[model samples]
Each structure stands twice: as C-alpha cells, then as structure tokens.
Target: MTRTLGIMTEGNDVEALYRRLAWRRQIVLLTGLAALAFSLVLDVATGPAMLPVPAVARSILGLAQDRTVDAIVWSIRLPIAFLALAVGAALGLSGGIMQTILNNPLASSYTLGVSAGAGFGAALVIVLGVAIPLPEAWAIPAMAFLFSGIACAGVYGIGSLRGSSPEMLVLGGIALLFLFQALLALLQFVASPEALQQIVFWLFGSLQKATWPKLWIISAVLAVSLPLLLLDAWRLTALKLGDERARGLGVDVARLRIRSFAIISALTGVAVAFVGTIGFVGLVAPHIARMLVGEDQRGLLPASALFGALLLSLSSIASKTLLPGAVVPIGIVTSLIGVPFFVWLVIRSRRAFW
Candidate 1:
C-alpha cells in the first residue's frame, strides 16, 4: 500500500481571498470617500471662523457663495486637505513598496531615513539663505525633493553594487540618515536664532504654511508617480520572494529593484518636500493594508494609497479640531500616533526589522 500526502488549495481559501479583496476594496473606497467628506466638513468647521457644517458643505458645493466661507474653504482648507491626502497617499504607497522590496516590515519614509535626507536638504536651504531668496513658497519642498532624491540614490547605489546585499541597504540607509542629521545640526549651529527657529519648525513638520500652489505641486507629483508605481505592481509583488527566487520565475531582479527604488524615492521625496517628515502613516498603513489584502500587489498597493489618504486626512482634521483653539501641525499629530504604532509593529515583527 502506498500513502500520499495531498496538497490542495481549499475552495474556502480561494473564496475567502476574493471575498476579502472585494470587501476591502469596497471598504477602502467608502472609507476614503467618507474621510474626504469629513475633511471638507472639518476644513470649514474647525478654523478660526468656525462655520457650521451645513453651511461649510454648501460653500464647498458653491451653493451658498458666502465670501468668508468660500474663501476659507477654497483658499485655506481645501488646499490643506488636498495636500494631506496626496502626501499621505504617496508616503503610504512608498512605505508599502519599501517593505515589499526589502522584506522588512518596519520600512517607511521616516524609519529608513528618506525623510531625514529631505529634512537635511530643507535645513540647508533654511541655513544658507539660498532657498529664502527664492519665492518663500517654493523653498521647503524644493530642497526636500532634491535632497531626498540624492539620498535615495546614494543608498540604492551603495546597496545594489555587484555582490551587494539587503543588509547593506538597510545599514547604508541608517548611516545616511545619521549623516543628514549631522548636516542639519551643523546648519543649525551656524544659523541666526530666527533662522534656526524656522529650521526647527520645518524639522518638526507643519501644515500652517500650506497654500494652494504648493498643494498643486505635490498633487502633480503624486499623479505622475502613482500610476507608474501601480503599473509595475506585478513585478513589485514578485519581489517579496528573494531576488534569486524572482529571477528563477523570469523576473528581472535588477530592473525591478532600480524601478522600485526610483518610485519609492520620488514618492517619499515629494511627501517630505511638502510636509516635512510626517512619520508612521507609511509604515502603519501599508502593514494594515497587507493584513487586510494578503500579499497581492494589485489589491495591496491601492489599498495602501487609499488608507494612507484617509489616515492623514483624518489626522489633519483631528489636529485642528482636537485642540478646539489651537491648530496642531499635521506632522505632530501623525508622530504621536505613528511612533507608538511603529514601536509596536517593530516589537511584534522583531524578526523582520531587528
């Protein structure tokens, strides 16, 4: 007699996976919409003017036409909301991609030092008086994107040389992060007190400086980059297995890594440029998305983007409304929630990141 151990993909597993994806997509879309509506409401209702929810809604819809409400909604809140969603989405998706590529759960815009690079760049502008001469509006993110790109490039190049390893990538990122932090410190040391204050504020992060133009720039970056990342979702998902494994399955590991690095760099760079170093959303949102959607890139990537948008939008609203009189910076709010979540994620997934 011969006995065989049988392997099967349970019908329940297949149905459960599909059902979960459908449910998650619907939930993500609905919650994302709800978060948007709530963001609009908070935009009109939470400012110094404090308009009623219905009136604020009407003004947004262009039905009321009250100048003050319209101005507040259009000139102020709308831009802020849009920036939060767009940056949040970019960070979220970047974090997801980083984790997938590195196979590390703690990977995020902040944790991996991408934000530190951007912060250092912004700090340079603040200290050197270079960015100051430019339109005050374009300064921060300009420096941010530039530095983030360079820093990411540095990390990737060092990590992907012949016979390079993931360990080198993580180590290099950490080292570069400290290097940038040192640069920020040196800039702060030579700066005047007032200039130093500006640098400090940017380092901590804020949305108080947000405007419609800046929002447009950030939104444009996301619009251009997100589709490209999504288009490569299949190759990205394949990266979860080892590069050698992916190659055996006919994936071009080198090309995939280069493409992913560029996309992640741009995503994180744009976000840090616009908003400073808002932490936790990218790391947390993608993990949440993975938990909900399994490992499929098609579902996982969009889910991270949607959830990220909702997370940041909600955080922005909370920072504004929670204090009742003082408008909290979006970064502060995110860090408060993010730091703890990150700590927990790392502790839980010690094998991955540690």
Candidate 2:
C-alpha cells in the first residue's frame, strides 16, 4: 500500500512537470508569433518613402484616408511585407521537416539541391524561352516550380535505388545539387549579356517584385501544405528518434519520408519560384525554433514558421536601411545576417541539435 502511494505520487509529479513544459512551449510560440507581427508592421513601414509606423498601421487597418499613404501601403509595401512572411514561413517549415526526417542539422532545400533545381529551371526558361505557351511573366516561375518538384522526385528516385535511406537521400541530394548547378553554369556561359544580367538579378533574390497575385499564390501553397504537415505531427516527432525507433512506434518510415519530401518540394519550389533563392532562413529559422520549443513537431513547426517570417521581415527592413538609399537584394542581406548568426549557433550549442 505504501509503495502504491509512492508510485502515484511520482506519476503526479511527472504529470505536473509535463504540464509546465507544455505551458512554457506555448508561451514561446505565442512570443514568436507576436514578434513576427511586429516585424511585419515594421517591414511595411520601412522603405525609401518611410511611412510613419502609425500611418502604416492605420492604412493596414483601413482607417487611413490619405490617398498617397493608402496607395503606398496597399499597392507596394503590403504585398512585399506579406510575401516576405509567406516565403519565410515556407522555408522554415521545409527546413524543420528536412532536419527532422533526415536527422541532419544542416538539412534544407538549399543543402538538398531543391533551390538549385529551381534556379536551373528558371535559368532554362530565361535562356531558352518556355516550350509551353506560358505568358512571358509566368514562364520562369512555372518552370522553377516544376523543376523543384523534379529535383525532389529525382532525389527520392535515386535514393530508392539505394533503399531510400536518409544517408542515400542526402547523397542523392548532393549529386542533384551538383548536377543542377552545373546545368545553371552551362546556361550562364552561353547566355547573352542581357539575359545573363536578368538571371543574376533573379538569383540575387528581391522582394521588389512582390505583387498581390504572387503573394496569394505563395499564401495558397502555405495554406495547403501546412495543414498536411501538421496532420503528421506525431509521426514526424517520432521520426526524430531515428528510423528504427520510429518504425518501432508503428510509423512506416519510408512512406512518411516520401510524403514529407513531396510537401517540402511544394513549399520550397513555390517559394524560390517567386523570390529566386533566399538562403539561411530555412537553415537557421528551424534551429532557432528548435532552441525555443524543443522537437515537438506541433509547437516546433509553427514556431519555426513564425521565426522564419520574423527573420525575413527583419531582413527586408535591413535591406532597405543598410544601404541608406539603394535597397540591397534581400538575399544578400539574409546571407550577411545568416552567416555570422549560423556560426554563433554552431559554436554556442553544447551538443548537436540533430
């Protein structure tokens, strides 16, 4: 009887500990979301015109009547600001999944060749023109989206030949990365100077081209993909414990990995399709999210998305402010910001995040 009471007491204590941890994780997620919202407002307010934050806030809320301010807010800043959020969320979510499924801290579309594939596809359209009857504006993004999927499929296909192990998939990704990069280089070598300039600018990544249509497309993809990922949150969290353990927990490891890759491709392909290739947000944001919320895919995934959006929104502001007048390419700003931070993250951690 005494032993029974002791066991019950211990169980209660464990339950309380879990409850506290869950509450703390919730707070972390809420804080990240709040930070992301503030950053979005700041991103919208920042630019050459530099609308007052209050004015931008009013404009956003439909309370402002000043035509000039409304036009600037609605027509230019809002789309860019919102697109930054969507793209960043997509990248971060993809990165988190990649890292989880592959058990690699550095796993992301950029590292796994998906971004390079999209770049190659865009370059193909730029250099060779769309073989299909696409509107001139649609050609590049369509091809980019297509090839990103192709890269995902290619990696999976190659990995399948080697039993689709995580190591095989990563090796396949490395090969795909080199293949697409070489193809891109070949296109650049033969590209006319004007075409080459356009390609380079696209590669540099910019939010200047953000439009309502583009924002909607990215938002739509995010809307679709996020729910699918969240549905498998438990399965994904299990995946973090390695394939043998996940399978021991009744997960079909191969199927889950394949499904994850499909979603990752959609998230990544669409993101880079529009924005070119913005690196590090995917790579760093998930790590940040992991630090805040640990590895529960439910909290971690949303946190990763929020932090990703926050990072990109902050980067957008810096891109405008860093150069005084000329807005730098956001990709360059992200790289500059990401590199040192990434180095710090690598050094500061007491042990492996993966």
Candidate 3:
C-alpha cells in the first residue's frame, strides 16, 4: 500500500512537470504575440507622418476628426503594418515546416529557391514589359507567383527522380537558384536604364508598395495556410525524428514531403510576390522559436509565426524611422537585424536542436 501511494505521488510529480512545461510554452507564445501587437501599433504610429498611438487608434475606429490622419492611418500605415505581419507569419511558418520535414536546421522557404524564381518573374515583367491580362500592379505579382510555383515543382521533380533525399532537394534548390538568378541577370543586362532601376528597387524588397488589396490577398493566404499547417503539427513533429523513424511510426514520408513542399511553395510565392525577397525571417524566426519552445511543432509553429511577425514589424518601424523623412527599404533593414541574430544563433549553442 505504501509503495502504490509513492508511485501515485511520483506520477503526480511527472504530470505537474508536464503542466509546467506547457505553461512555459504558452507564456512564450503569448508574449511573442503581444509583442507583435505592440510593434504593429508602434509601426502604425511612427514613420514620416508620425501619429500618436491614441490618434492612430482613433483614426482606426473612425473617431478622428482629421481626414488627413484618417487617410494616412487607413490607407497607408495600416496596410503596410498588416502586410508585414502577414508576410512574416507566412515565412516563419513555412521555414519551421521546411526545417522539420527536411531535418535541416538551415532549411527555410528560400531554401527551395522560390524567392529567386519570383524575383526573375517580376524582373521579366518590369524589364521586358511583358503584358498580362491584369493591371500592372497585379500582373507582376501574378507572374512572380506563377514562376515561384514552377520553380518549386521543378525542385520536387528533380528531388523525386533522385529518390527524394534531403540532399537531393537541397541540390535541386541550388540549381534552381542559380538558374533563376542567371535569367534575372540576363534581363537586367538587356534592360533600359529606367527599367533597370525599377528592377533593382523591386529586388530591394520594400513594403512601400503595400496596398489594401495586397494586404487582403496575403491575409487570405495566411488564413488558409496557417490552419492547414497547424493541423499537420503532430505529423511534422514526427518528421523531425528522421525519415526512417517517421516511416516506422506510420508517417508516409514521401507524401508528406510532397504535400508540405506544395503548401510551402504557395505560401512563399504569395509572400515574395507582393514584397519581393525579405530574407532571414524564415531562417532566424524558427531558430528563435525552437530555442524558446523546443521541437514540439504544436507550440513551435505558432511561436515561430509570432516571432517572425515581431521581427518584421520591428524592422518596418525601424525602416521608416531610420531617417527623418525618408524611408529605407525593408529588405536592407531585415538583413541588418537578421545577420546579428543569425550569428548569435550559430555561436551561442553547440547543442543539436533536432
């Protein structure tokens, strides 16, 4: 009887430990999410226009008497802030899944060369003036999205032909990256000075081009993809245990990889289509999330999304405020901020996350 009582006490202690771990993950996720929200408000409030938080809130609520403030808040700052959040979330989630499925900590959305393909497609439209059925604004991102999908398909095809090894996928991605980069260079070489300048600026990845329509489109993509990703959370976590182990545990590794690749391609394509290539969010956000929450995909995925949103939102705020009246391109700011964190991530730990 005493032995059974002791066993029950031990079990209770184990259960309590699990509860504490769960609570820690919850706190990390909530804190990251709250930070993202606060950063969004700051992003909307700052910038060249410079509105206070109260004023920005009032403008959002339609309680502001000032038409100019309303226009600035609703038409400009709000869209940019929302796009930052959406794009960041998509990239972060995509990155976390890519790393999990591939079992490579370095894997990211850009690892499959989706960004390069999108950039090439956008360059073709900008430099050669390719005509599409849509308006100029819509046409560029449309072509970008199309080519990104094509690039991902190519990588998958090549990887499958090579038996879909992780190394094969990485090799295929490298090939696509070089291929699309070369094509973009060729276009730039032939481009007129004016077109060349536009291509350069587009490649710089600025959120200054954000619009309400673009915001809605990206938000829609995130809304659809994030839930799907979360639904696969358990399976994705199984994937981190290596392909053989995952297969032994009843996961169809090949099918999951294919499906995950497709979803990642769509998410990444939409993101880069609108904002160009914002690097490092995919690479860095997952690392931060993993460090905070460990490898459980259920918690890691949402935390990654939150951290990604926070990083990009903070970058957006910095980009606008770096100079008095001039806005810096977001891509540059992200690189500046991401490089330090990336270096820290590399140097700070010798432990294996996977």
Residue 345 displacement in candidate 1 (angstroms): 5.3
lDDT of 1 by residue, 207-258 (tens): 7767877777777877887788778777777778777878888888777777
Instruction: Tell me the TM-score of model 2.
Output: 0.98
Per-residue lDDT of candidate 3, residues 1-354 (tens digit): 999999999999999988988999999988887888788888999987678898887887779988988988888889999899999988898888888877787778675687899999999999877878898888899989999889888888888887898888877888898899899999999999999998898888989889988888888888887788888888888887777888889988898888888888888888999998888999899999898888888899888888888889999998998888989888889999998888888889653245
Top candidate on lDDT is 2
- Candidate 2 per-residue lDDT, tens place, 106-161, comes to 88999889999999999999998869688867889999999999999998999899
Candidate 3: RMSD over Cα atoms?
A: 2.0
Instruction: State every prediction's TM-score relative to the real structure.
Output: 0.88, 0.98, 0.94
TM-score of 3: 0.94
* Backbone-clash count (model 3): 0
Clashes of each: 0, 0, 0
Candidate 1: give the clashing pairs.
none
Q: Once model 3 is optimally superposed onto the true structure by TM-score, how far is the C-alpha of residue 351 displaced, in angstroms?
A: 4.9
Best-first order by lDDT: 2, 3, 1
